[model samples]
Target: MDNCLFCKIARGEIPSRKVFEDEDVFAFHDINPARPLHILVIPKRHITSLATIADTDTLVLGRILAVANQLASENGSPDGFRVIINTGRIGQQEVQHLHAHIVGGPEPVGPMLKRV
Candidate 1:
């Protein structure tokens, strides 16, 4: 994982505009945001993708979501926000790491919730 982008970000080797961080999770603004309030919430430990998550990883998964919730609430979208987890290449999992994309904006965000 030494050469991984997100791993580097988690280790602070690569600078990112961090929004939140804790013992198990880290969040930052997406470099290429699709929405005005786009942030990427990821785990400190690399898990490849959602397809690779194990039963033991459930706790971390929940923590990722909790962090996303807090981030969304803090970003002024307590009532509206989108949590997206792309699983594979077809789903646009550009980075080989488990991360949740939290998107919200002042405009109507309902259409961005289209199921993939």
Candidate 2:
């Protein structure tokens, strides 16, 4: 996990525009945002991806979701937001570490996905 980008960010080895941080979770603004309000919420402990999550990860995982609303409302997009967790290859996960992206703004984010 030493080399994992999100772990580095959680450990403060890398700088990020942090939105929220607690004993178990870390939320920060995405450096390259896809939406007007975009944030990345992650666990302080490294978990490869959602595909690799274990029962022991429940608490941390729950904590991630627990803080999403507050993080979004405080940062922006109080009306609503989208929480996305891209898993493995098929999910188009760009980062190896498990993280949920909170995206929204004054306007809708458009359709969840395009028709295949």
Lowest lDDT sum, 10 consecutive residues, model 2, at 68-77
lDDT of 2 by residue, 45-92 (tens): 989998899899999988988899888888778999999999999999
The whole-model lDDT of each prediction reads 0.91, 0.92
Report residue 103 deviation for candidate 2 (angstroms).
0.1
Candidate 1, residues 1-116, lDDT tens digits: the string is 88899999999999999999999999999999888889999999989999988998999999999988889989967777999999898888989999999999777676655698
- The segments of candidate 1 whose C-alpha lies over 4 angstroms from its true place after superposition are 112-116
Distance (Å) between predicted and true CA of 40, model 2? Answer: 0.2
lDDT of 1: 0.91
Q: Candidate 2: what lDDT?
A: 0.92
TM-score of 1: 0.92
